[model samples]
Target: MKFAHDVIRKPVITERSMEGIADNKYVFEVAPNAGKIEIKKAVEEIFGVKVAKVNTIKLPGKWKRMGVYRGKRPDIKKAVVTLTADSKKIEIFENMM
Candidate 1:
């Protein structure tokens, strides 16, 4: 059983993510080991919002070469959490506009 805090690493703030806020959806950088259900529960508990849906994206690591050296970027996982229609807006982005 992972703690709610551990399930969600941090909020993902980007142009696309910011746009989602207007639709009662928020983006988060969740733990790679977390699943959709865990993400939904964690977000609901931490933010006090009713999560209606949870969409996840898994970004694979990319390979890079520099001066005959090869390196890989770290893989990342993100979750797009959509809140229920009647839920209150998250206060964190209340004044972002």
Candidate 2:
């Protein structure tokens, strides 16, 4: 697999994701075309951490209503990377005032 920089774009920050990260797991909104192996490689390389496990989920697009037309949200892929106990940390929020 290619290095993480070419696979994962960036980490996703949100309420739920922050909660997970606080528990020692990090979440990211990965490219829809990326898979588990790709995600694993990306996280390890980009974060400089030891990836113990990788989990992926594909979220279906949501339907939206319009007066005379309808639209759907784009599908997205999510990855949860679990790091080794002694791996380096990713401090998402250092100083936000």
Candidate 3:
């Protein structure tokens, strides 16, 4: 198993993610190759919460062209972690204003 630090890169601090905080759901940006199981383990290990469910999405890379040059952005993997009702809350989101 990969280390928690390696599996979960960081919390995704977006307006949409913040809205989920009210529902015991947290968003995180994970490694491109990571799966839902890995993300669940990482979130559990790092946040000490029981993950009730994990939903993952792979954002397709976007293509951009500039001055006859074209490049594609790297794909991103995101995980939405839903904690069990009995689980403890992650404190980091509490202080977010």
Candidate 4:
């Protein structure tokens, strides 16, 4: 079994993700192999909040070129975690807002 920290790689702090905080939703960059069930448990364990829903998006790597070379950005998996209505806000994001 993966540890909570291993499942949740990092919080995504983009403008869109930050906007979600107001609605009790937060975005995270998670392990590529992680599923919704693992994500739900990780969030709950890390933040001590009840998760109401978890939505994931798999982003394919993009191709890029430099003068004479080409490379692809690494693929990524994102998770949008929604907390229960009665749950408290995640403290980490609170200071960011």
Each candidate's root-mean-square deviation in Å?
1.3, 2.4, 1.2, 0.8
Please write out the lDDT profile of model 2 over residues 49-84, one tens digit for every residue.
888898888899999999989999999888888878
lDDT of 3 by residue, 3-95 (tens): 989999988998999999888999998999888888898898888889999999899999999989999999999999999999988988888
* Backbone clashes in model 2: 1
* Model 1 residue 76 CA deviation in Å: 0.8
Q: In model 3, where is the ten-residue run with the lowest total lDDT?
A: 88-97
lDDT of 1 by residue, 38-82 (tens): 999998898888999999999998999999999999999999999
Write the candidate numbers in order of decreasing TM-score: 4, 3, 1, 2
Error of 4 at 19 (Å): 1.2
Considering every candidate listed, which one attains the maximal TM-score?
A: 4
**C-alpha positional error of residue 91 in candidate 2 after TM-score superposition, expressed in Å:** 2.8
* lDDT tens digits, residue span 1-97, model 4: 8999999999999889999998999999999999999999999999999999999999999999998999999999999999999998899899888
Q: How many backbone clashes does candidate 4 have?
A: 0
Best by lDDT: 4
TM-scores of all candidate predictions against the true structure: 0.90, 0.81, 0.91, 0.95
Better of 2 and 4 by lDDT: 4
Candidate-wise lDDT, in order: 0.90, 0.77, 0.90, 0.95
lDDT of 2 at 19: 72
Which stretch of 10 consecutive residues in model 4 shows the poorest summed lDDT? 88-97
